[model samples]
Target: GAALAERVAAAGGVIGRDDLAAPTAEWAEPVRQDGIWVTPAPTRGPALLAALAGERVLVGGPTGEGTSVVAAADGEGNAVVMVHSNSHPQFGSGLVAEPYDLVLSNRAGRGFHPDPGHPDGPAPGRRPPTTLHAWALDTRGTGRPDLFGATPGGEQQVPWNAQVLGDLMTTGPDDLGAILTRPRWSLQDGARVPVEASASAVRPAHVLLRVTGTGLTAAADPRIGAVALGV
Candidate 1:
């Protein structure tokens, strides 16, 4: 899949095709149980497909699942982390060579093959099936943290990190940046659903919230600009 369309054009999102355009075998076939070839994700143009074919329609494409996350909480509480390498260029069947192979470039993300009876398939050394989810909610655990978050959009990052932690746990802690700048929803894999023009009606997925205190206020998803920093 051209490394999932160059990791969704290097994470700036939007994969309307033409990464160099060359695959024309009906969108690269050959899945014969597991011969692996896969490719068929590209759309959302042509005037939104002529206004979604004026009726009955279903669409899907744009799945790169790349990642990069950071969550920390100190002063003796504990919670520091780093997560990288995900559904990006994931050098699996891609080429890699020349002077001992220099690093950087999908850095080693996608790799796993052993499907025996499919149960997340692949075995023998199993490790493929990672959406790289991050979460935090020690509300009752006593750690005091209530709603932490993470997102990069791959499998829509766990329903957009559980719908922004259920709207910051039912909109508490005073606005918390207006419940992460409001308007959000996501659920895809069928029946098509997309909403985020500052989301007011339709709904599906997109998130990045933080509800701690003292010095970590955050909110991201300004229809993609995603920004919010308060120190």
Candidate 2:
């Protein structure tokens, strides 16, 4: 389909009148990793949740850098929604119309395949898997609903957020700045990006971290510079 679109759009190519139909967007069930919910949105919510579960991090930490959610139902039924994204801008270029002045070019349909047997196999107008994550929590006393999201390409966003959660829950960083200033993610992909630390701290052997609050806690990989700030 991509090939067709590119060729048809080539110089003086004979593309049928109906060939250029309006594109459509669709939604599907979110993927779950380690009990955390993840949607394919170019972010890392599920991975973060999983890491937090592993670490057993609690909410109400002195300094944690993640967005979480909480919900409660009283005798009278009611519903609420609260969401937040890290709001970090991607910095690069390639695609046209740099509306955000950043390179989301890596998000182009590369992992997708044409074979039905493959996990990322292509289907007619089907949406590709995204890295974005949406999480929620619910309890009786208080209702806190939060959404932690970002746009780090690949899975870079997960580890960054997870480490911050660890610092907040386990290491007990004094403030948000201290947690962030600590030596952060070291990319697994050495060929692409070298792993580096901002401060002198032992890096985890595994490239994953998790955080948990009173209602729900989650972890993510920070290798992609993913962060989870409060809404």
Candidate 3:
């Protein structure tokens, strides 16, 4: 967490954990708006995007190797999407428990601001601003998830996921395959918007699943050789 970095900064760039202990975490609720739910403020991608969209401003944005996303739907019209990440490569935080090797999330380390007073700043047990997020939508007023999806692209996660959700809402589920497999662009570093190579972008994969009157439809990005299969 930032405490280690803070201590090091206070010590004028020394490396040691003399008295600091590993960070801790607890359960929290998701943030919901309209019919969509997000991963909450500390994971500020959704909100940040909203701010940008509100002003219609231009700006940008990780590697997705340490992250993965999955979506599922059942017979009861229930659907879910999950985006999991280690915050960084190699199990993150590197704070594995002695026996079980339970790894703690490094969201505070990579997601937190350095300033003490910033909303996303580091504090003991404070959840930092993470880019990891997804969108869940229930368009039918069923109070249950009717459509869910997410993508893995680290800093690009927000734009990627947001674009897919936008397309989903606008075009519905029939075009899932084309929507994800189409050439995509990401605003990198808030300076340049670069489009991925057609049929060659390697960091590829996204899942969109929607429940319709007939059944559940799922689409998988094919740029990285992803395929739709029954399980």
Q: Please give the RMSD of candidate 3 to the true structure.
A: 5.8
Tens digit of per-residue lDDT, candidate 1, span 70-144: 555454344443444434544322443334452334322233324467544545434344544444444333445
lDDT of 2 at 195: 36
Residues 74-167, model 2: lDDT tens digits: 2233322233322222321133322333322323243355467775665655555543344432212133323232222234445545654556
The model with the greatest TM-score is 3
For every model shown, the clashing-pair count is: 5, 39, 1
Better of 1 and 2 by lDDT: 1
What TM-score, to 2 decimals, does candidate 1 have? 0.27
Q: Give the per-residue lDDT of model 3 (tens digit) for 176-211.
A: 788887666665555435456323132557887888
Compared with the true structure, all predictions reach lDDT values of 0.42, 0.38, 0.63
On lDDT, the candidate that comes out on top is: 3
- How does model 3 fare in lDDT? 0.63
**TM per candidate:** 0.27, 0.44, 0.71
Which residue runs of candidate 3 sit more than 4 Å off their true CA positions?
A: 1-34, 48-64, 94-98, 101-104, 138-145, 195-204, 225-227
Instruction: Tell how far residue 151 is off in model 2, in angstroms.
Output: 6.2
